[model samples]
Target: MPQELEIKLTLEPAPADDAYRWLSSLPETSVGPTKRLANTYFDTPDASLNRLKAALRIRKAGDRYIQTLKTQGEFVAGAHRRLEWEWPLPSAVLDRDLLLATSLVDSVSLDELKPVFETNFERRILMLDDGKAVIECAFDRGEIVSGGQSVPLCEVEFELKSGQEDRLLYWASKLGEQVSFFINLISKAEQGYFLAGVHRPASLSAGAEPVSKLFHGLSRLWLTGELPQEYVEAVAELKAKETKTDWRTEIELFERLMAEPSSAKVSDLGKAQLALLRTGVADE
Candidate 1:
């Protein structure tokens, strides 16, 4: 196995919306949905750079956990390797699987179906909303292989595409968190908030106010085929709830704008909104 070589750049949150627009406007690349991934990551409490662990995962209607051990050094040129091992566990939890992976990083190869892997350096981020909320962002460069063939070419991801990206980017900027991408480091659960259970306001309510309400607005636009009062009212309601002028309102407003008819102006707005949405989801 060769170590994966990559770089991560922190994206400034203030320009994240514009950054998203920039990314979308570029020629489309080898990215988007065709494969599925759910990884369990682990780390030590001290937050040292190298003390990280992870469990690469496979889901066959159920779940399979492959333990992987990884160590990071300065980014190097050539084929970098991620060592992996298949482990037997009493019960499979991502954290426990991550521990096992730490020991097996040398055994797994990039070419096998039992496990699919990719190689690319990418960006990750920790986002906050007005100093009150947090989410993780990962943009990966790699491939998914099963049985020695390509399944899906991995692209940069803006995950948790349920909320508005513009808002989160704004929030990250206002919170003074550096928004640039990071060097490629393979620690999945850096904050451990996802496992500890981050709140899911969007998943719960069709009408309930989302702390990040942009996804709902998009859903409405996509489903109705036309923007309605619901879209505008949702923005107002969210704005009032914002109580403070942050990215939250901006996101809702952008999402509303995305729902407009796909005219030339609307197309540009949609493209811009898509960038914010993509960036926001990645941070999650």
Candidate 2:
């Protein structure tokens, strides 16, 4: 079981080429060979896997196919940590025996799985070695196809190959100076689901169990100045059923913070709100 620690930044399709050029020009960057990746995502008709915040995909590179299962974990302030398991496949098809060996064995059956969407992308990778840390920066450009409709995929990702997570963030900030990008919380798999008109289940949990997770997830979106409508609705629904006064107050403050206009830079007020959420008190 390997943990992937990375940050994904979304960019406009038009500026993606220039951003790649700038990335390749960095003196400390070591360029890796580019490859085209074709991936097919699978799930049950009702999306039993997505409701669990898990993704199942088989990626084809040349004649080699690899199956991957990724379970969602903590994501905060542009950083993501997730559980990932990958296995080499003899062919492009899903291996039922192998699938049964993992965590998804009981939740979904082999006969129920079907291809819902696909993503095709050309990836250009760059490695930055600053003596103490190694960061692999990947620029992916392509489109996600579902039901004959396509959505452009233009984003840059920084994965910590080795070293502290702070080093990854430092380089991400430095690259931000050259490219205008937004910290994207949505993953390619999630985008595909959205394109397929599959909505997220409102049943996050039955009771107060979902509060902490919602708080952290929404707080990260606030920090990045992103307020997706689904997130807004989720918080509203959660707050309505919450029993704890302190947690309900936190949710209300978060809503108020999101309602206010956000500046180009991370606002002082936004920082204050995040601090308050973390410490249960506003910083002086």
Candidate 3:
């Protein structure tokens, strides 16, 4: 059971091209050969795996096919951690014994699984090693196809091979200064699901009603250790508009919590305060 820790950033084609050039110029980066990957996602007709927050896919890299199963894990800011299991395949067929070894075996039948969407992308990888930490940076450019519909994919990812999670954010921020990029909470699988008409992507921006967004944004900032300035302003404006005095106290408590180390566990008081803040958002 390998846990993947990475930060995903969504970029436009022009920005992606600029970022690629910038990354290639860095002396410390070791660039790997570009490879084309074709991935097909599978699920039962009613999408039992999707409902369970699990994903199954087989990726074809040249002449080799690899099968993978990933279960959704915690996501903070742009950092995503997921439990992944992978195996090499002799052909494009699913391995029944391998499927039976996992939790999905009980819930899904191997025969019922079918391809729902496909992602074809060309990936260029770059590596940075500082003795203690190794980060693999990937630039993916391609399209996701499903039901005769397709969406272009242009993004950069920083995957922590062995290092502190903060290092990934540090490099992301450094590169972000040269090129504009936004954190993408949705994964490629989620995007494919949305395009397949299963469900909509989760909202990332604060809308006209800012209370709920403020609370959610603050929660992510506290958990991920990456706070966007817009979220801070939104929280301030929402507090000013409200007459409740307790909301101000709750905001202050959250600010203090945000300043703590990422390894710090949330105290009982903090949990209660968070619950109160969520209740306030719901009441609004």
Q: RMSD for each model, in Å, please?
A: 15.8, 6.6, 10.9
Q: What TM-score against the true fold does each predicted structure earn?
A: 0.28, 0.75, 0.72
Name the Cα RMSD for model 1.
15.8
Candidate 3 yields a Cα-based lDDT of: 0.71
Each prediction's whole-model lDDT (CA): 0.34, 0.70, 0.71
Per lDDT, what order, best first?
Answer: 3, 2, 1
Q: For residues 1-284, could you state the per-residue lDDT of candidate 1 as single tens digits? A: 43433222223343444444444343422223232344433332332212233334422212444444445332121111244445544343433434333444354332221222322233333222223322233443333332344322222233222343344344323222322332112223321222233211122135444322343334334333455454466456544552322445336445546454443132333333444433433233
- lDDT accuracy of residue 107 in candidate 3: 86
Clashing pairs in 2: none
lDDT at position 131, candidate 3: 63
> What lDDT is reached at residue 136 by model 2?
89
What's the lDDT for residue 165 in model 2?
69
Off by over 4 Å in 2: 201-284
Among these predictions, the greatest lDDT belongs to: 3
- What tens digits encode model 3's per-residue C-alpha lDDT throughout 1-284? 78999887777788788888897788768888798999999988898888878889999999999999998776543467889999999988877678888898778877899999999999989897756578998999999999999989888989999977767766776676567665555678877887898754333444434443444454445334565554566556656675544556556554554465354233333333334433444245
